[model samples]
Target: MRQIWHVGKTVLGMLLRHPITGTSIIPLLPDGRIVLVRRRDNGLWALPGGMVDWGEDIPTTVLRELKEETGLELVQLGRLVGVYSAAERDPRVHSICVVVEAQVQGKMQVVDTLEIIEVKDFLPSELPLEELSHDHGQQLKDYLNGMTTLA
Candidate 1:
């Protein structure tokens, strides 16, 4: 998990340094699963999100990113989970991430745009180790451990 940690720190740094404008989702499924995506950039699974265009609202941004990245329509959105940053999470630059709770209800599909490599729904325990972002992994672990509820 050394690489994962480094990557997490990198992402954190990018967000801090550049103040990136991005949106992400914690898409909860009907059966209480979460929607996760494996991106082509690093082949790791992360919450669905993307950079926002100028003047876009956070909720709209989250909805757009989810559909563009994972082809899911969200039903509800809740509080901001948290913002993360580090020196090594992203290689390009610091990415300012806005993470929020999203209730998703729709047929799932991989966007043909090719940003995402794959999509999956799994119990927190069943998450593929290869696809997890080291930092977000902790959040998932916390939820799985019953330390936090999807608000």
Candidate 2:
């Protein structure tokens, strides 16, 4: 017998239930404030990101999702913050998110309001970690711990 798993609208063989691939960015302003989006679904603040589509590489997904969610096109991509794969990181599904450090060069706007209610910037020490969605607070914690140098 084969095991089965459900992910979003698709079903996968249990053994093939590889964690979904996603990318998120800790978009920083030149002044050192980090960008975050407020999720419309649950009203929790989160880094801008989304699931990686089939046939897309992680870097492409990172850029695309950043643009889609935050309208940031001129960004300087930095080092990988870390890869988060805790089984309970997300409430919706088991997944892996590649967290990257980035610096956005432009005005911040809420482009994908359906998923993001607003965009805001905050100093790392001033982040409302308790209000972040999905394991984003932990991800940000990893960044602040000097896991990677932000650009």
RMSD, one per candidate, in order: 5.7, 4.8
Query: What TM value does model 2 have?
Result: 0.85
Q: After superposing candidate 2, which stretches have Cα over 4 Å from the reference?
A: 1-16, 148-151
Q: Compose the digit string of candidate 2's lDDT tens values, residues 1-151.
A: 1233244324432655688878788998889999899999899899999999999998788788888777776467887998888767877677888889987867788888789898889988899987899988888988888775221
Which candidate ranks first by TM-score, i.e. highest? 2
After TM-score superposition, the amount by which residue 150's alpha carbon in candidate 1 deviates from its true location, in angstroms, is 17
Q: Which ten residues in a row have the lowest lDDT in candidate 2?
A: 1-10
Superposed Cα deviation of residue 40, candidate 2 (Å): 0.7
At residue 116, give the lDDT of candidate 1: 84
Q: What is the alpha-carbon lDDT for the whole of candidate 1?
A: 0.72
Candidate 1 lDDT tens digits, 15-58 = 66555666567788889888898878778898788777888988
Lowest lDDT 10-mer window, candidate 1? 142-151
